[model samples]
Target: MLQLASGSSLLAIAVDRFLRVRIPVTYKSTVTQKRSWMVVAICWFTAALLSFIPMFGWHNYNTWNGTTQANSTSFECRFFTASSRSYVVNFIFFGFFLPLLAVMTGLYCYIFLTTRRQLRLNIGAATESHTYYQKEQRLAASLVLVLGLFVVCWLPLFLMQTIKLYGPKIEVSSLFVHIGVLLSHVNLAVNPIVYAFRIPKIKEEFKKLYMRVYHDGQQH
Candidate 1:
């Protein structure tokens, strides 16, 4: 699941970069495809390494069979009830929410900087050609939408986990915890689909990639 999430995140970033800066006629040919590939590779490697922490001893994990008044799911991803409450709260706060917040913040920052530059240069109006200005707004809107959905879906799970940790006195319903996990994992897949279908250039790239594979199969 972590590996898949990482790949989807990287692909989203690549698609975002292509839309915002690289795919414009002015910049597309000059920015080598290899550079984009490298960026994707780095995202994958970094996610893979970071995700190994829970699997390895950095994040706490354990099997819980204790019976409580309000049942939580047997399978908890963020933190185990058996672990230190403070540590669990910190993990949920910093490990998941903080990073997500940072990424979204960065995206907004990029959008802000891009808009400021365009305004300063007096290129705010749409040119006859497809310039970065024309597409960046729509792309930024889409990214904001995507990230908004991500935060909405995943934030609940983190909040629930944090509540369970900090406010241990309050019992959470098992069904709610399970639902949270479902939402978070669902986020892992949504971004890629949005890019492949919603974004025109990305859809074209996929079409070309598919055609190349199909032609190669026919040749063989």
Candidate 2:
């Protein structure tokens, strides 16, 4: 669920950025507040729908061929144990991650190139264009940072899932999955810190706190 939400939000931001660069005039009118809310609702609905599918008889315990469980002993719940392997391979990897990632990457790349070209032209509204391009450049850079961090934090888990699904079953596979899970959790923590440092108001407060802490440490 966390992954679906984060990936969806990132994809939304990338698409928004692409549109803002590609169609400045129509972008404002097209991306209205009401429509934005609609997108949010759609994301939530899709996440809920996909996650719930496992419960409706598409699970490892009761999916595809037959009961995969060898022992009848009830164990601690795990994703692979509960969710269908077919679901993980088909939807999670190929359906969601691959397509979403491909689109977002293409959009960001287009935005980067367009912004650069606009700067090179610099024909009309010199000051305004300069400011706009600079702002766009900063935004592009920030988006890259955010997206890169997201991939860094989340890729391991997905890769591990892929290996777990396809690769030969081994003892170390469990360790890799555990490490991947830990890394995914790290992303949840890192995103807030990254955003907080980027926001003007929050960044200013952070600086103030840092200075105060430094003074307190020096005095002691």
Winner by lDDT: 2
Candidate 1 — what's its lDDT? 0.63
Off by over 4 Å in 1: 1-31, 59-89, 109-113, 116-130, 208-220
The best candidate by TM-score is: 2
lDDT of 2 by residue, 1-220 (tens): 7778777888887878888888887989999999999888878778778888877777766534555554557543354667766787778878998898898889988888888888878856567766776687788788788889888877777776776667747334566777777777888778868866665566788888999999999999
Report per-prediction Cα RMSD to one decimal. Answer: 5.9, 6.3
lDDT of each: 0.63, 0.77
TM-score for predicted model 1 compared with the true structure: 0.66
lDDT of 1 by residue, 101-147 (tens): 67656756676576557655766555643364656766666666676
